[model samples]
Target: MSTEGSVSNDREGHVKTEGERSFWGRLANWGLYQTLMTVITLSPRRQFFILAAFPILWLLTQHLGPMLQMLRVSLLDAYPVAPDVAQEFSLESYFKFFGDPIFWMPLFRTLIFAAVFTLCTLLITYPVAYFLARHVSRKNQMLLLLILLIPFWVGEIVRTYAIMILLGNTGALNLALKWLGLIDRPIPFMYTSFSMGLGMVYLTALYMLLPLYSALEKLPKSYNEAAADLGAGAWSRFRKITLPLTIEGISSGSTLVFLISTGFYATPVLLGGPSTTVFAETIAGFFHVAGDEWPTGAAFAVIMFIVALLITGVFQRLMKSLRKGESS
Candidate 1:
């Protein structure tokens, strides 16, 4: 009878262990099924919308709110006295921007400066990029790149001041020239558009160089050799093969240089005089020198941002179309 009882007890223990394992297995399968169902039920569009909401919310909080507030104030005839104050919206700031040539002229000038600087940067960086990508050894390429980045290790303000010292009438260049008897008097190079452009180019040249280098580096030598084998000349090979391949890099770099150049404040302020005033300078004047009009400053900032965006979009689209043409 004792032996029979022992066997029954062992069977009961085995049954309990099996039951516990079965319960956990069912729970895990249910969880997996729920997850699969959720994924299968959501449409692509719905999933996209859900995923996009976070970024949209972030943008609204960070940018759109300030932009709307600025637009509201810019349209007001008079500044509000308090946070709760209400007034009718007017187009005074927009009218001021358009009707006054001072505001519009500076905007145009800024655009011109950015364009010219970008073009100059491209011209200067392309040859260096080509040499680094095609001719240089890997170790030397890295060393040369490091040399280019060395200037940026110093603060921008320090670099600008260094440029100032070098370019000033009584500065190092003038002293050296005078010592060499090259000129009778010190040349006035400071506080001019030339100086400002030089400074802008110096600051932003790396942006152009890096992208162009990256694009050129990825190009295989086989393409150039093939073009040569087909009886293509050097200029023809470069124009048809090399330039076409590096279009994406050129576009990206130019856009970055242009955008940064438009908003440049410190370099322009230090190197430029009255005639070389940019839109950023005007925005600064409106906020700090003038009666601290946050709304007007905000409006200017938004307009500048939109203009930059449009320019970038157009450039990217043009590049895309060109790429498509080349592929076809």
Candidate 2:
């Protein structure tokens, strides 16, 4: 009787243990299912904010910190005359930049040069980009692209020097021209606006080309085919369809080229005369060559930054408007 009782006790213990385990398993499954549902039900906007938080924090720390520091420096009365001494906070530098024609004139010249260069870059690069995107065979396209990129292998400074050599009074082009009796005297090509523009164009041509090519490449060939089928001539198809599709690229390339060209110092200094001084040169002169006026340099830098921001904002709005019009 005792043995039978012992066997029954063992069986009861085993059943109780299984019941406890099943209860815990059901609890665990319920918690896991609830978690999954919560995750699935999260709003996309909330998720995006969560995902973007770290990157936004990082960017703020990187960019805002330096900008604040620069602004503080600009606000202080600093001069190069006494390198070791610090002056009280003053608006002298900002006033100097605004009140002085030397600073303002160069800034104006810089704007004009950048605008002219941007226009020339667009005019020259658009046709080349269109041809490459639409006309060339795949095999030849690759080869031509390689050729276009070959000039970039050389450094910008080296290329500028090369331009100097080719355009200098006694340079190869001048020698050839003399041999051909094109001119009796060698031309003074270096240290001129023409040379400055040429160098700027050469350095920035690729910038314009890549964006334009990408824009043109994204255009549907079907549009052109349909236009042709509808008795539209080649020029008409290009004017109506191809040009409209590539405006974004043109705007993007122009903005980039203009911004870079505006801030250009080395090319202008090397190739341009005194009359062709750019804003960047003025900033450099204030900081290093003329006198170490940190506040003045900072003021100029701030103004340039604001101008660039304005240009970029305008371009973005224009692009958006164009896209909306196209969609409509």
Instruction: Pick the TM-score winner.
Output: 1
Clashing pairs in 2: none
Model 2 spans with C-alpha error above 4 angstroms: 1-58, 79-87, 289-292, 319-328
Predicted model with the maximum lDDT:
1
Model 1: how far residue 106 lies from native, Å: 0.9
Can you write out model 2's per-residue Cα lDDT over 1-328, one digit (the tens) per residue? 9978866765665587753345334454587876875685598887787779889998888879788766777777764437567667887777888797988898888888888998899999999998999999988988998899999888878998989998999999899999999999998988888999999999999999999999998998999999999999989888778877888898889989988898777888889998888899888876775545777787788888788779777977887788668656
Candidate 1, residues 1-328, lDDT tens digits: the string is: 9978866765665587753345344454587876975785589887787789889999998878876777777766666545677676766666667778888788889988998999999999999999999999988999988998999777778889988999999999999999999999999889988889888888999999999999999999999999899999999899889998999999999999999899888888899999898999988887774453655666677677788889889988998899879867
